[model samples]
Target: MKIAAEDVTPVAFTVILFLAWEGACRLFHIDAFILPAPSAVFAAAAHYWWPLLKNSFVTLWTTVVGFILAVVFGITLGLVVGWSRAIYRGLYPVMIGFNSIPKVAVVPILIMWFGIGEIPAILTAFLISFFPIVVNVATGLATTEPELEDVLRALGASKLDIMRKVGIPRTAPYLFGALKVAITLAFVGAVVSETIGANAGVGHLMVQAGSNFQMPLVFAGLLALAVEGILMYALFALLERRMAGWAFRASMSAAG
Candidate 1:
């Protein structure tokens, strides 16, 4: 099959970015400790491949597990909240207040409770990601047209039936959108907790590298996190296109 120009753009853009970065580092005679060139970063990644691989896996595992929990709980709670405007409004402030507390503060509490293991990282990821999913799903359902509901009601559809048949389906685009955002946040959450307390994970690796003055390795750890985040986001984006392609079609039709 032939490759699309669209598919090539991102790769080209990334290459250009890396080249610019490398050129700037050379032009400025930047110290590796201050900012490693992409070449040095790649060398570190290659040299510490095994450690990077193991730590990256640990981070991925915790992040994915926490993200899964967020998806299940968030979807259920979002559905319940969106079922009625009263509950949505009532719970909105509570959720906002909870989400407002920086995850960094909560990490220490989690470390105390979970004792510096993967559990804290997992929970931290869950806590960080949960709100966006809930808000987006709830918004998707709550924004359902009142006229549409009235017509369905007049046709003898029960509220539950209407929600099951229409509301949930319509919420797909929003849920998928939230999934993309939440997954990235979940990674950030995992890395943050790992940096604070965990024995394993890219965050911990970076911390070690920084203390040892291995700036290239530290940058390599960051590169690993960026790569993982991009992959997860792309997965959700693909799922969105596959599952909610109709939403796009509808929007385009309206626009035209």
Candidate 2:
């Protein structure tokens, strides 16, 4: 198979970025404690591969668990809220207020209730990631074209039938879009909770490395997190395209 420019561009840019960063550090004689070169980071990763792998797995599982819970709960709540204008209006403010609060603030409370473990990380991820999903699904349902609903009703369709045939289908693109956003947020939430207090995880490893002034190790932890986040986001993006290809094509065509 031939390589496409779109695929090559990101790889080329990433290489350029790392090369520039490494050159700048060498030229400026930057202290390793303040900012380790990419080479040092990779060396740390190689030396501590086992620990990094174990911690990365812990973080990945916790993030996936939390994200799955968010998807189920968010979709259910969004549907309920979007079923009626009154419910949507009443719940919107409460949701907004809750989402506005920094999730980092809630990490301590979760840790207190769940103790220092994966449970806290999971809950923190769920809390931080569900908002966008809820909003997108609700908006998609609420904005269903009235004319379409009228035609369905005129054909003797019940409210449930209209919802089943129209509202749910319309919400697919929105839900998928939200999934891409939520996955990233879930990673943030999980890592934040782990950093606050955890026995194992990339976040915990980073904290230990930082305490020991192992800047390269800390950067390796960050690199692991970045790689995981990018992979997860890409997975969801691919799913979105596969499942909602028509919606995506329409969007692209419109933009063009």
Candidate 3:
């Protein structure tokens, strides 16, 4: 079963809000320039469909790249730290300090280093979004049952064999949990970075729309971004359901 509330909730809420918004705009005789009705926003989006999709793809690509990097680096570093006491002790403090710093504050430096393009946006997304994944994965890997470890060792399993047979498999759920969080942060980070210094993306389009007082266009851009985020989230949820079927079933059975 889907972990999410049924899609009907958001769909119904959106339909009702749009109807209310349009009615309010008509009743108040609001000018389209101020707060355009949902209809007007849809019309604008329909008219600009191609450019909107193009810009969306640009942002989507950056987000995807950043997310992949975060997962790879986060999982790698997490495994290294979790499996080695020395590295864990040595790097834990530095990781905490770096994570404490506001990632957005480093955007200027990122741009200075990588220039105002996809690279900077992607790097910013990776930098800000990777810490949680790493921390959670490390914790999960390290906190496995000590009794299990002892049993596996008595059975003559080597360190590598134990890690392969037990550690990573057990940590999959935690890694995916972090993926859920990382995906959203990755989206936000990419869009925010693009907004700060991008010439071509949905964020850039929204900035342009705001500058020209196109509130409907701004709303439309935001709506598109929201849709993209929802789609990404749903994709992850679907993958999780499929990949964790046994675990999810076990969870459900236990809960019941």
Which is the leading candidate under lDDT? Answer: 1
Give me the overall lDDT of model 1: 0.96
For model 1, residues 1-256, the per-residue Cα lDDT tens digits are: 9999999999999999999999999999999989999999999999999999999999999999999999999999999999998998899999999999999999999988879889999999999999999999999998999899999999999999999988999999999999999999999999999999989999999999999999999999999999999999999999999999998889879653
- Reference-based lDDT, each prediction: 0.96, 0.95, 0.86
lDDT-sorted candidate list, best first: 1, 2, 3
Off by over 4 Å in 2: 252-256
Ranking by TM-score: 1, 2, 3
Clashing pairs in 2: none
Candidate 3 has an lDDT of: 0.86
Query: Which pairs of residues clash in candidate 1, taking residues 3 or more apart in a chain or in different chains?
Result: none
Q: What is the TM-score of each predicted model, taking all chains together? A: 0.98, 0.97, 0.89
lDDT of 3 at 150: 98
